[model samples]
Target: MALRVRVAPSKVVLQNLITCLILFYFVYYVSLSMCCLILQVYELDVLAPFDFKTNPSWLNTNYKVLLFSTEVTYFVCGLLFALVVEEWVWDYAISVTILHVAITSTVMLEFPLTSHWWAALGAGLISMICGGQTLAYCLFKDNFIYPDLGNF
Candidate 1:
């Protein structure tokens, strides 16, 4: 005798939800990075530790760039955790990113005013929503599901 198997629609919905979240963040990651590289300017160190350094404004720009790639990788990791390992990373990592951004803006870079604030706000909202959804899905009482991160 053969046993019959069935799949639920929730699983498909969950997969799409995860993909959308990843895509949303990925786009944000790219935009922020490009803004830094192009809109902002930086200068390499004239003569310090033979290190390339730039102005605070430039540093801000580079930071966006770094965040873009870092976010991409992190999201990818989350994706893998979902797919292969069936895991969700809803820990300090996300909070750390937010905190670091806040801290650096306050302590180091001269924050961009006007439009940038609006942009940041939007980004924050989106992140919160995505993070919240991911958390909700992870903790859902009815079911537990994790995705296999598609491709690298």
Candidate 2:
């Protein structure tokens, strides 16, 4: 047994390692970059910063590009984490993304980008909490307890 699944010694450990890397490094990078975008939006008074920001006919495509890129990264991370832990919560993933995207984008578009950094911190915390369990599973696979409660 591995750390989390209580079986599949090698496979679970290997997968756990992958989960840690993806949840931490890959997702971490994307979220870090997003902080900058959030900062700019907040400064420029743009709440729905994820929509297209262009002239009426000239394709205000900046916001769309940002949302698409960020959403893809967020969705991928959520999907990978769920798959690794055998916790395929499709509804949860969609809800989180849709809620965040709609709220952030619409707010930025209609109102002033007055959201503070504290809100962004909350987002980061939520991200970590959502994915932290899977990440810990992967990282602690090597130092694991067997079915008999024996440590390796």
Candidate 3:
């Protein structure tokens, strides 16, 4: 006897992956820009989202706000991604976060090394997954209902 494994067609998978990536970054930047505008209202650096500095004190109000706003943006992006993708929430979430980190590292000329920076990234990742799962379930709970097998 042989067991057959089924996989999605590569073209379809690739297309979906590309769509997810594009959507994730598009929503992320747009939301981040809005957050930056709010930060600017308070005279904080508008470029804080791009800063990977390890030297600044995380205790600073500016840093705290930046971190909070970033996490919120991640959550919103994840929620939107989940609503669109409607499947493979974990894979897409991790892929986008890794891509974001890689791009940020390349642009900043250094990998983020600060504990607080990493903590924020970790928190953002968690929020992304949680928000995605929560919204997806809420929107599609009926789809997940299983039929009564005992009646078979």
Candidate 4:
């Protein structure tokens, strides 16, 4: 007699599970940033309870650039997430380069250009979220929780 193991219902779903989680994290990042920016603009003091001052110099930049760059970054990330797969081609490589340039230029422009702490706060929080997601992915790899895409 030979021992046997049951297989998953769908191989594609299993293969793309990690990618789906990454895409979800990216979506959550954009939504969270928008909410934070809205609250900060109205001076709602959403973070008043904790009053955590995460004033990283790189985040504070010209209001217009901060807003536009963050929005563009979100868009670019969404596009890139859609392109996730086993093999990345030239287009993905180029887009990644562009994203890096956009973020770097805007961050460096913080000192000479105008600065908005609120925008910085929103962007910084998103960065932290991304960092956490990255850490989780690194630690868990394929074992991390992933939803079943077949139901949807």
User: Candidate 2: misplaced stretches above 4 Å?
Assistant: 1-49, 52-68, 83-85, 109-152
What's the true lDDT of residue 122 in model 3? Answer: 86
lDDT of 2 by residue, 29-114 (tens): 46535654754433322323343333222253444334433444554565465555444233344344445555546655553243
Off by over 4 Å in 1: 1-67, 70-98, 107-109, 117-121, 135-139, 142-152
TM-score each candidate. 0.29, 0.31, 0.71, 0.26
Task: Write one digit per residue (lDDT tens) for candidate 4, span 70-122.
Answer: 44444444344434532322223234334444444565543222244444434
Give the runs in model 3 whose Cα sits over 4 Å from its true position: 1-8, 41-48, 54-62, 142-152
C-alpha lDDT score of every prediction, in listed order:
0.44, 0.46, 0.72, 0.43
What overall lDDT, based on C-alpha atoms, would model 2 receive against the true structure? 0.46
The residue-by-residue lDDT of candidate 3 on 1-152, one tens digit each, is 99998767886667767887787666655666666676663565445566667355656656655676678877887788777766556677888778878877887888878787778878888988888878878888877556699979
Q: Model 2 residue 141 lDDT?
A: 61
The residue-by-residue lDDT of candidate 1 on 1-152, one tens digit each, is 99998768778556545554555455544544454556553442212111112232435655345444344444443443334323233432344345434544665455434454334444544554465447556655346665578874
lDDT of 4 at 29: 49
- Summed over model 1, clashes come to 8
Error of 3 at 106 (Å): 1.4
Best model number under TM-score: 3
Candidate 4: list runs displaced more than 4 Å. 1-115
